[model samples]
Target: MEKEGLQRSVEFFKHHNINIKTLVTDRHVQIKKWVRENMEDTTHAFDVWHVAKGMKKKLFALSKEKDCSDVSPWIKSMVNHMYWTAASSANLNEDLILAKWQSISNHIINIHDGHSTLFPSCQHDDLEGRERHKKWLKPGSKVYEKLQDIVNSRQMKKDIPMLSSGQQTSELEGFHSVVNHFAPKMIGFSFHGMLSR
Candidate 1:
């Protein structure tokens, strides 16, 4: 669906009073616009992993102009830090820290700022919200508990395995597998195709 269709869907959800606490999406202008216009109360968050990937892409692009490879890792680490900070709270201090880090390359930093602006306003005490999220986890708390159990089981396997050379990289490995399965065949595909059903 296009922007208009997304807007319509959001309107319908709003009309029906859907309990959409947060809308997670990539940085798409249409989705950003629709969320701004219709879902003022809903929390809007761009996916952290996507933001990091974008930063990495831009860093690679900038490497031609200025040898950014030396500082690229630092910049990426800082970018990830910014995501955690922004995800935690909307305080000006965190924003300022992010701004300062991006100021390495003014142009690149500006792009980062543009990405940050797409999200809804965050509050200083937003970290409290993360704690509250635990109470509302999907499939109930039991599911999360079971997940923890499975993780513990995997750790046990690692310790007791008859032969082991490398550490388990299940989460990261699984992430790449899923990305390969679902990401577009080429770059610049429509956001709807990339994300929506």
Candidate 2:
């Protein structure tokens, strides 16, 4: 299905003289390779949410580690942090994205200042208030190590810049859901039904 979709899309674009320079999509390994092999002129980017979800799964697994339950509580916040880092670093490259992500580690540790290469201190102004309600991970703890492993993963490092943009398939998914209402998947449709869809 992906191959057919790509083929039709390529044909449609060629027929309409649309010169696509880049395409952003979820992290499907097959599609990634296909795009690279077939669309050499186009740059491929993985959607940030997909990447963050993947990271979340990995982190969740790591949180089950012995004495590392502390990492589990931070998973959601870390995923949100990934999204924020991506959205805020659109004009920047992978290095800046990684640096910004690393800053979150500093933020979690209450060492908001003098920790990030990109920022002199934590960007949040309500640090004191947040600190009052939160328990920070101690340095060299098992949970901290697991969190570091995720942030520094090779896949995360490679895809930071791609994820740093707003492109996503969320709206596409919504559209598909609406289409399903028009053309219910459990039943077959006639020519009119197909045409209406």
Candidate 3:
């Protein structure tokens, strides 16, 4: 089913003379692998929200750990950091993306300054004045380690580049909700029901 949808989309674009430079989607296992093997001409990026969602699930699970109980509360902030990491590294390569992402361990410690491979020190300005309500976590703490593990995982690394800087599926999801209002999934549609929709 996923392959058929992809093939149909490719055919539709080709028929309409639309040159697809990139394809952004949630990290569906089959689709991700299929696109990598088949769509060499197009860059595949995973949706930032989906990547964050995956991280949230991991963090939630980790929060149950004996030393990692504190991680549960910080899940929301960590998800926001995922978006921040993606947005800040716009027009940059995967290495920069990884560097910025890895720097979060420093950022959470109220150490906005960092040492990444691409940048010797933190690139952003000092957050001294604006950074109120700061929640600092030690780098070597179990919660921090769990958070880092989730952020630095192999799947997150692979999907970092395609994290959307401009386009987002939030609006698309909203549109689907509206469509469902018109053509709800629960009811079986007759000819007139379909037309009404």
**Least accurate 10 contiguous residues by lDDT in model 1:** 159-168
| Deviation of model 2 at 169, angstroms | 1.3
Which is better, 2 or 3, measured by lDDT?
2
Q: How should the candidates be ordered by TM-score, best one leading?
A: 2, 3, 1
Pick by TM-score: 2 or 3, better one? 2
lDDT of 2 by residue, 1-197 (tens): 87778779988998999988778888777888888888899878777878888988888888788988777667888888888887787668667778887787777776878865666566776655644567788889878877877787787777776773667778877998998988988989998977788
Off by over 4 Å in 2: 116-120, 128-132, 181-197
Q: Across residues 10-33, which tens digit of lDDT does each residue of candidate 3 receive?
A: 889999999888887777889888
TM, every model: 0.41, 0.83, 0.82
Model 1, range 1-197, lDDT digits (tens) per residue? 65776678777887998867666655566777778887778756555555456555554554444323343334454355545544444334434434333332322222223434523333324334433332222332343333223323432232111111122224554786778677745666587877752
Per-candidate count of clashing residue pairs (backbone under 3 Å): 0, 0, 1
Q: Number of the top candidate by TM-score?
A: 2
What are the C-alpha RMSDs, in order, of all predicted structures? Answer: 20.2, 2.7, 2.7
lDDT of 2 at 66: 90
